[model samples]
Target: MGRTRDRLKKAIAQSRIPSSHGIRYANELLALGAWFREHAEGVPAFARNRDLYAHVNEEVLGDAPIDLFEFGVREGSTISKWMEVNSNPASRFFGFDSFEGLPESWRGGVGETPAGSFATGGAVPRLDDERVHFVAGLFQETLSAFLTQDYRPTGNRRVLHCDADLYSSTLFVLATMHPWLDPGSVIVFDEFDSPLHEFRAFVDYTSSYRRRFRAIARTGPLLARLAVEILE
Candidate 1:
């Protein structure tokens, strides 16, 4: 009788909705949201942020010296991964973070993560190689100068990895980073399941610019991968 009861419970649990289904359903809604926003305005489009980076490196970057940008480098593990997969001598990697944590609490009811969470007390991992650089500060304070003055500004494909959790921070990075994106660039969002933050920012940014992108790949159920390439 106990065996039967255990089997029954297992059957019921299997019959229940799987979390991946929820991810799919949420992503579908996100797709619709992007569509509506695109029609209304424009739209544009991470992982450990490495799997997607590897996908892009293999599929799009082959032999090309690309520029990689990672937002939210907590322990700098992702930065190290990028360097590992990319061997092009001229390639450069830029990691941006407050090194303190989220600038604020993530948007409403999203999760328990609070403002200033993930703070590293301004200490970040040091990568000795010159090919890699770190920009330490709030996004608003640092991104503009990097976009305009510090970066080489030309001759490389752009790859962006966004790990920041808040809606405002994600939105700011998207809006600020848009002008630099070109066709063939790849953007990977590490926590895209937060509908109100990363997801919403993406829909608005793409719609606002009337830009077009296509979902090219996905990593697990959390990361969203997108590509902006000219259709020919």
Candidate 2:
């Protein structure tokens, strides 16, 4: 397991953050998840193992070939969820992370950085979904050409999620994906009320364009995540 995870982490760190890489990765994980569940399948303590991911994916994916991504896939929960519902022989999920751990400068919530939170710090949980894929290291990049590479089969374009806790990382993704997004594309912000820089930067950047954003979904909490549509 250690060797497998290390290999996955390495691939995520080195490859481009492709739109389809994630889904493919999740599908590959299914065998491992099933194997673990086999031995511990009936245990009550494993209740959390109801496979939340499968439930979410089934509801969201249907029979379509959707391309999914998680800006902050800490321990791969959301990625797992995407895998459960969408992991067909044909789906793609991409997860980005700073695998070594959170950045020392990730201050964006109410006050200080989320304490004892963020990445699980433990091994990634098992799940048998080949659609999920992880990309380690920071997206501290300026150029956005990575968005166009290794794309999946879909009309939705790219779905770029900004969950980098810090203000700068969030803004960077918005600016980068801006040119690539089409009408149906969506951007999910993990913390819109970040006291740091995210809220201000996104507000300021969108304001410059005649096309502002329209809120589509919000999970709640003052600084909760946000999903909005970028006007054309």
Candidate 3:
């Protein structure tokens, strides 16, 4: 059996088929679909992301104030939607972004988004809400520092919104925030259906950290936006 497996591996290593983006993406989707069947088969689904957010705020999270951390603040639209959904005065929203767009190119099933795709000229959003705050800089540069010096732990439930549409960014946020992710914490992934990016990062993070989560809700086609609650 071992010799047969080695022979198969050797043959695959020497195969001449050149892989393209479409081919790779198709394989990723197949893998992602299998995973979804196992873990996310019956979760509630929503048509739009905002509706999903509202459901999370009202149904899943209830009226209690939460510490909402948004990892990708492109134009501040989603974070703003979160603020609108959770109106408790005690809830705090922290948005982290370069405000300069994606740190690297994002190759999706559709096409490639060039680096700096969502750049806002390094300007943060102009939201008037006092409870909302923005942290500017790369996640690699800013998240750890913020977690160390500025992060204040509270009894409030924590909601982590991961919209960073790259594997590196998502993985960094997940691994860094692992220490603070108590069981019952809620995590929402904005581009969850991107098999090579968010989905891959999520699988890697959970497996590496030995963490468990249960899907609570999903939105958009092919479960594009997904929410999960940490089980332990």
Per-prediction TM-score to the true structure, in the order listed = 0.75, 0.60, 0.89
lDDT for position 102 in model 2:
56
Task: Report the Cα lDDT for residue 168, model 1.
Answer: 84
- Candidate 1, 113-160: lDDT as tens digits: 678888889997888778888999999999998888887766888888
* lDDT by residue for model 2 (6-70), tens: 54565456545463554344344333334323322332221132232232233333445666766
- Tell me how many residue pairs clash in candidate 1: 10
Error of 1 at 223 (Å): 5.4
Error at 53, model 2, angstroms: 11
Give the lowest summed-lDDT range of ten residues in model 3.
1-10
Against the true structure, what is every candidate's RMSD? 8.6, 16.8, 6.7
Worst 10 residues of 2 by lDDT: 43-52
What digit string (tens of lDDT, one per residue) describes model 3 on residues 1-107? 23323433443455444457556665676777777888886888899888898888888789689999999997899999999989999999999999989989998
Total backbone clashes of candidate 2, pairs 3 or more residues apart or in separate chains: 24
Model 2, which residues run further than 4 Å from truth? 1-63, 85-89, 108-110, 114-127, 141-145, 152-154, 221-223
